[model samples]
Target: MEPQSSLPDDLLRAAPKVLLHDHLDGGLRPATIVELAAEIGHPLPETDADALATWFAEAADSGSLERYLETFAHTVGVMQTASAVTRVARECVEDLAADGVVYAEIRYAPELHVESGLELEDVVAAVQQGFEEGMAAAGGRIVVRHLLTAMRQAANAREIADLAIAWRDRGVVGFDIAGPEAGYPPTRFLDAFEYLQRENFHFTIHAGEGFGLPSIWEAVQWCGADRLGHGVRIVDDIKVDEAGVAQLGRLASYVRDKRIPLEMCPSSNIQTGAAPSISEHPIKLLASLRFRVTVNTDNRLMSRTSLSKEFALLSEAFGYGWAEMEWLTVNAMKSAFIPYDERFRLITQTIKPWYAERMSG
Candidate 1:
């Protein structure tokens, strides 16, 4: 961990942040995973909590997306039971709230948790129950919304889309398709995207993280995604000169012109080898060009980071300060998958006012 001098604990501890991307199955507590695995007779990489945490972090940082995703099997294995799902979801809420997140949108595939004969709705209900419990027990106010993800490798996109629409007014805020991005293009889920579009439901697509500009192009042009999840490789579409002049390719120009929100998970991007390192992260390039870039923790447990840790990394890498952090926070708020009225209310009533007070002090 970097020193807190650049991003003081005072600022990080109190920063009212908005999180756009996170995974439910990817953020379990190591000790909780161990106990849950024990109850279900599921073997774990390590019996000790600290060692297990280290194991997960190391496995995810191996520079191979397939290897990084292997660590999730243990977490998802223990999440098949309803009680386990509820417990993890509630704890996830408490953890985010404690980390000073005022609002968050967490996504996970429900089909991955139905192994023990639980129906799809049962899976969603269990997670919703946990979110309710966590919010009630939160040390402060925290609002959480669920985003249902359909695995690209699986043939359940239509079902997941219907599930998202079913839970729209209940708790599900948006829909997403996550998994291998190379061969399985967003066009494979045409029916699902069409259904969501007809219903006017919000959705985001995982794009341009492991893949390149073509994947991002398909995600926007073909899929009509409301946001681009980890659209780091959109940088591949940018051409820069020795004089620091930048030229945007057609795809990059379209993304910027359309103002599609880019869900940039900086640390996770580096760990996944999406960017060479933090200094060359597309976030700096995209932010400088005024793309609708929002910062996030893609998977807190796997990445072993929080919103604060993400900011701390950005601060050290880019020399960020209060103003930069504030702009990023507001960018996230603007690019959120919520209704305009609610987004404005959060900005004016929650985010802006809180930060304004901090600045005045």
Candidate 2:
């Protein structure tokens, strides 16, 4: 941690953040996209930086996941070569460190980056190289890990899962299945999940965002997801009263009982229409109910946000003071895919002391 900053907002920004649900392709620099697209002879709808940024935000605000995902065509288009991948991954870390993310697991589908004839291993290697460079560039102030993702809409999950295991010590921290979750249930990739289970690998599934409680249930019960991605739809299984009492369905009770982490992205949930607004977000209910909830930025480019921005929005909606913020950050670190000792070191050596000072200030 750095020296204590005087500004309240600065303190919030300086606080240690652990992010488990950020997307690599979904958070590219707009200017980098323009340049990379130009070099690759790919045409974007708007080449101008400002217009391109607006295009992503506006396209993603469609209140529909499928429509919102269409905007990724431009981002993924330019990110084919090794150089592009490394640069994007490097800049992602720098940006996250600037936003006060002390640790982050950025997931990306290697298959998506293979359009340029690069093998899956090649893509993973490039990303690992980039993450290492970024970590060193940050002077070891941040730890950037990669989560190799397999698109649920595709059929290469087993391959990616194997790759994740093979590269686990080589910088890949975990595995994930990402894509539209409606028709493509977690059970569709049961073989991969089962393999991961047998191998003692960690994985998270994209569920209960564009889908509902059923998706989350399958991810947890059937696929055995270590964490849930954008699980805002878990609210569907929870009934609340005017008196603030919540009646949890059997599945909800099990999720809470198991202490499963919900990687909730408030802004992206609203953009994807999973939630009506931040103020009305179920995070407040879940947090109050003591669910293992952690805040995150699902996509920085589309949402035009960072970790601090998400914290600020949540603070406004839930009146979260430093204590609440610290608890949520600790929740994320505790739920991280890293080893137990490393996570503890981060919490005790960095997170706890920083928040203690800020809270008592």
Alpha carbon lDDT of residue 111, candidate 1? 97
* Residue-level lDDT tens digits of model 2 in 1-361: 4223233688777888999999999999999999999998999989999999999999999999999899899999998999999999999999998888999999999999888899999999999888888989999889988898999889999999999999998888899999998889999999999999999999999999999989999999999999999788888889988897899999989999999999999999999999999888999999999999999999999999888988888877667878888999999999999999999999999999999997686
185-286: candidate 1 lDDT, tens digit per residue: 999998999999999999999999889888888889988999999999998889999999999999999999998999999888888889888878889889
Model 1, CA-based lDDT: 0.90
Candidate 1 residue pairs in clash (backbone atoms < 3 Å) = none
Provide the lowest-lDDT 10-residue window in model 1.
Answer: 1-10
Candidate 1 local Cα displacement, residue 259, angstroms: 1.4
- The number of the candidate with the highest lDDT is 2
